[model samples]
Target chain A: MRERFITLTSPVVPLERDNVDTDQIIPARFLKATSREGFGDKLFHDWRYDSAGCPRPDFVLNDPTHRGTILAAGKNFGCGSSREHAAWAIRGAGFRAVLSPRFADIFRENALNNGLLPVQLPAPFLERVFTVTRERPEAAVTVDLERQEVRFEGETAPFDIPPYRKRCLLQGFDDIDYLLSIRDKIILFEKQHAL
Target chain B: MNTLFDKIWDAHVVEALPGDTHVLYIDRQYIHEVTSPQAFEGLRRRGVPLFRPGQVTAIPDHNIPTLCQHLPVADPLSRAQLDTLERNCVAHDISLFRIGTPHHGIVHVAGPESGLTLPGMTIVCGDSHTSTHGALGCVAFGIGTSEVEMALATQCILQPKPRPARVRVEGRLPAGTCAKDLILHVISRIGTAGGTGYFVEFAGTAIRALSLEARMTVCNMSIEMGARGGMIAPDDATFDYLRDRPFAPRGAAWERAIERWRALPSDDDARFDAEFTFDAGEIAPMITYGTNPATGIPVTATIPPAADPQALAYMGLHAGEPLVGKRVDHVFVGSCTNGRLEDLRAFASLVKGKRRAPGVTAWIVPGSQEVERRAIAEGVRDTLEAAGFVLRQPGCSACLAMNEDKVPPGKYCVATSNRNFEGRQGPGARTFLAGPLVAAAAAVTGEIRDPRELM
Candidate 1:
């Protein structure tokens, strides 16, 4: 399973809010589905629509201008409730990376394990991306997992990514994958302990 | 240094594998309906019966409705999941406490209360709030579904031992401040995620002064700080709480267990990877402004400026905005965190005569049927109902927005739950995390307020 990691190809959409919790990312009503599909359609189900099921045109994602494979959000994204489904919906929705100032620890772990890149960019950098995404509808953003840098069209600075998480994402490695990489060591230790 | 983490880590390590992880045997495995479904499926696929069925205990809490015991589950998926758990437990010969059973409650609440949690045990559940059991001086943490399967198969997990932190709270907690407030204050001071990759040992006078129920509340939020777990040394209070618990030993066995528990405290000179101290009196009733638990201040104070560049940019809140008197559309007072009988008594004490603010929807859900029964017997439920609040059946209602209970979008809710992260109550619903009393006060005023004045 240790193979070349696939780079994210979907366009990024920016949701500029801090403390975006699991419930908001995917409401409880959506959890009724056992399969992890159909979640993409319900991402931000209540926020993007009104009570009558009409789109809330005022929301950023509801606006046509901000469409992309990456979502550049405000700091502390995925802040409340440790539901892995939040990460599932984000990944299932075809988003490659979620850029924020920080993330709730559980959400970060969930995102990484589920093959979603939750990038921790500085506040100014995140703000710049948000502005650029809002300003240029066609602008493309690139996140190089190998280099651990995020680059956007006409952007002057490259944001930093934690080296360890970057390595995992770049290799498409989850905790189990990382552990399995050293299977021989585990066998050896098990043998020694058994004796 | 021989910190609690090192001692526990050393004791539990079956062997150190080459991948910077240690193979540690889990002493106790707690299962709930939500996460156990996939794990049971994995077991079926692997053709593995539970390796040590006796070590596992399953409970149906999150998805089961509280009040309707004999009625079918309202949600099809929740019912299927609960049914799957019941079937799986029976197939594997593992113990289960189905809803309406005396042992049933939120798994975290039920585990320690039933004496399934004890000092020196390594406990893991598929739910994040599993850290609540750390209050029993154990190494408890949450695991994913896949990891849960691995534990059921081998009764062992590959884990990287965490560094240890000793958080000491000294001085008397002023009247009306509680263990919930103390933990929230600790999160605020240290910042959420400060204890990441660390096991926390909560000590000092303030922690000792708290009851076992209160200590569970503090440890329950340890996960919010990204810690593996939190613990307090076992004392008389711990023994007393465990004395006649269903699963606890009785007669001479109880005395023997107490003898062992008494020696579970860390040595006076024991060192920690990190240490922090706080004056309990300095903490007041706290409420979260931003999406994270750490973004908190006294209810009387204004929301602090999102001065932390990251916090400000994310929260969209200007500094010095008063959190007090901010209008709230809903008030939710339940969760594994603070949905106990004691919490209800506190909330009822504040809302006894006053009516729930007009136009505000308040949900009062007990953590368990036992809690519900206790509250009803104590007249707490009557007081709440008389005040126009609806007492909902048990389960983790509106805490994670998993069940039918949820706040409408853009509405503000004062919640006694552990988290105030953005949209915790519902989509775009702002949640102000507070204690039960503060939630009661908010229910009355229809805004964030201190319960002291209301009483």
Candidate 2:
């Protein structure tokens, strides 16, 4: 997996819902897979499909007008059940980042670990994003991790990204990778503490 | 800086190598059948034997059918997973609690009842609800599948220290309220992501009034708030709960254990990274509206307007809708959250001589064989049967959709399970979370009604 803190390019599909839980994001039936592959198609499977396996035209993502590589959701996105598959599906579906007003704690961590950037913006900022995305269908939003800013078409706003997570994303480091980097220090400390 | 999480992490951190991470030694490891099979396979492939067999305990729960102890597991994959767990445990000489074994139950429930979980120890499990053990004043959290393998092979994991957030519950709980209600209120108020990146410590007067089982209910939902885990200072309640448990100390040993536990409370002036306080009396019987547990309101309250477009669009709920009379097609009372003996007793008392709604299907399941046996002995099973409710055996029966007890797509269920996340009961199944009493009332009314009406 590419670890660099690269810029996201997906069009922003805004979902203004609180408590967007993991099961809704990716259903349990999809969890049976042993490998993490092919989850992209199953992301939001129920919402995207109807009883006959036909695409639901009424769904937001299915709307041809709102096509983007990024998903800008509402407050408390990715709430409920600590399923990492939700993040995996979002990432596999070719989306690199998710911008939201608020993110569920476990879901945020899962997204970050799987290299999916979860951007938390204020409610007002989120509203502004939805307005802009709605008004200008072709609007492109750029999320710069290095600068900690979200720049829309001709407008820019600064957002908060925790310093630790920022460092990890910028360095393309996961929990294990970050820990392994300090292996020598840990070994030394263990040696010194040996009694 | 001196939070329980920091204390535990610092004590266990043997080294900090080149990267911003620490190599930590694990004190205890708990595993269940659902997540351990793949981890064991990984270990086998790597030729890694368990480092400390005694520190690990294995149990089968998630896939075990509730109603039939002898019914061959209908799902081939679930049966294979259980068989794999038993085979692995036997081959590795690890303690395995198979079906019908006295020790077989949800791993979280089994751990505390067995006295294997004690104060001041760090515990790790493969399930997110492992936070349930934090009620014993230990730092416990869930690990991923790969991490489970690492723990089995080396009994250690690399982890970053987490910050602490203290949640204090003061005032006396009103009649009809419980720890389940308190947690639901707290999560709803904070939203689901409120506890992210923090170890929560629950305190104050109202919390003290809760039984250890109730306290476990509160701590079990810590992960729902995005918290790493939750802890409550050990006290008389804690000691009392542990005293008569199967694995607890006896005679002089019991007194010594209590003495040690007494010192496990936090210092009076101890500082926390963050603090939040809520009044217990202000809480009411809470129920979820949208898929997530945090989108909850008092049983009598109307569903809040989906002010946020995303929330409204996703939940498919209109503004100003009275949640009270929302139609429910099913009622589920089971899971580690509310599948205990007390939970069944509460449901049974409410359902006795009361016929369930003709259109509603209610499945009441016990968390373990012990809980089932105790409930049967107390006549709760008979009461449920007479009331037209189906009492299933011990397993995580509809709290999740893993077993055959799933709600049909597009149906609404009032559940006693911890999470009401979208599709938790089944694909496209709408779940409204409530306490057992409230769930019983819903079963009888065929709608989201308050338990107080039944009383």
Candidate 3:
């Protein structure tokens, strides 16, 4: 079973660009592997590496000073393509939560299923977080799923997460477990609504 | 008052849990190579058998080589993935459509042409283009591997109900434009995040006038604008497209199916969470200049001055410059979005007598074996070959560059496929997403030109 995600307080890696798509998270070329693990090295493959396979220093992940467990990105994070590898890569790279003003629907679902916390804060709070993190790389932000709030530098903002998702994250529950428990209902429904 | 989305979604609800989540039963689940291996592995690890194996269909498309289907795949990794899919299907007793079979193609294309996608059914696949199936008026959307495993184990998924939105495009499309242009124009108006939490429905006179295949082209790219999925109410056009296909109902059953389908449209007083209306006459031949599909403008317009500079640098284009006269290095006209037979005909009609440009390399691929067969039988293939375009075998070629159709680094391609994401075609490749006519125009002129001028 994956680790339970309850609350996290850690420094963040800020990606200020909006519409950071899945292709930029994990390119199409790295998707040939059957296993979901071992993708941490390939996360953001194109943006992190040059043609020679050398790390590009200008990229955020390449910088040692900006290490963290949370990825604070601009709006529309995880747009384009429904590849869960993007979520897998982010988790494999050791991040626990993503703080964005918005997230694409499929990606949000994938992130939740795979144990990545997607925190949807307001745009103004995100702007403050970006500004504060830029000035102090080691500054930490706290995400409390139970309280449904994000706290940073004496400022706290309420975020919205469905109660079902919150319970699953708090207890390390899997959707498959819930789905498998209700097999009889599924069969009954299928028999009644035979297409 | 019920919307079409509500009619389909409510019927498929097996149970409703708290927090607005539902255990939605999926009628059809299509599996492909790239995303299904892990899902099958999930089943094996849990030691559970598939609940309804017959409801699932496996077809490998993403990583398969578009050329030489009979030959063994050269890439060891790609070959292993394909082999894994075949083995998994065999083990689970699920139906498989391997390469070289008459039924093989991209799942989105193969599903509709085989009549497996019908009105009011809930469909799903691991790939995002599963939204393409919603063109038949189904509540179809994409899922990840874990959800794929959930569907396999129980044929049901726990989903939070998405709100409904309506985009009504009225009036007739201008002569030079088609469904692709209309969708691109809509995406341009509504930025990538505009439809984030809603399932959008296409309505009004203009959408009703499009053919079934053309409607698929519109719904296929709904994800590009962040919608959960897109659909059009199943009409006579949709029924006619499915009437005689192999998997469709026949005789008395066909009549019954039509009777049910006729009730699938929204009622006159149905209300939506959001509504947007556009005049089809305002849309022109469209093209995307940036990395995302939403960064689109008319073919005759200059790049917006507010365009992202980093995106422009990566595309080797600059703001305040006319996109019309830019040189193009490659032209690709195939994908689940616009790779149907109708798309091929639109391409062939424009490039009929024109010679290929001196420096442009063009690849014309069919979406499915059925499309390929009809393209040849109807002389579209002959016309294309005469215009210096080679018709490649059917697959998702050049759309995501999973196979041998990668555009070289730093080269520009005018393509009719969806998603112009950076490195989507290949490493360092720049793509301009457009309809088939725009791609054909670039193929003949060796540059970006408004397809309207050519017509």
Candidate with best DockQ: 3
Number of colliding residue pairs in each model: 10, 19, 0
lDDT of 1 by residue, B1-455 (tens): 35555665576676675544576767899998776776677567656667679889998777666456688887778877778888989999999987877777788877887888877678888777888887877788887565677678777776656778889999999888777889989999887668766789999999998888889899999877767678888788877777787787789877776776676678778878889999998999888777678877888987665545544444445678877778888888888899888888888889888988988888888887678777888888889889887777777878877666878877888888887755566656678888988998989988877878877
Predicted chain A of candidate 2: TM-score:
0.89
Off by over 4 Å in 3: none
Q: What is the TM-score of chain B alone in each candidate?
A: 0.95, 0.95, 0.99
Quote the lDDT for B111 in model 1. Answer: 85
lDDT of residue B376 for candidate 3 = 99
- Report lDDT per candidate: 0.76, 0.77, 0.93
True contacts kept of each: 0.16, 0.28, 0.81
Compute each candidate's TM-score over C-alphas: 0.83, 0.86, 0.99
| Deviation of model 3 at B337, angstroms | 0.8
Selected candidate, larger DockQ, 1 vs 2 = 2
Rank order by lDDT, top first? 3, 2, 1
lDDT of 1 at B415: 86
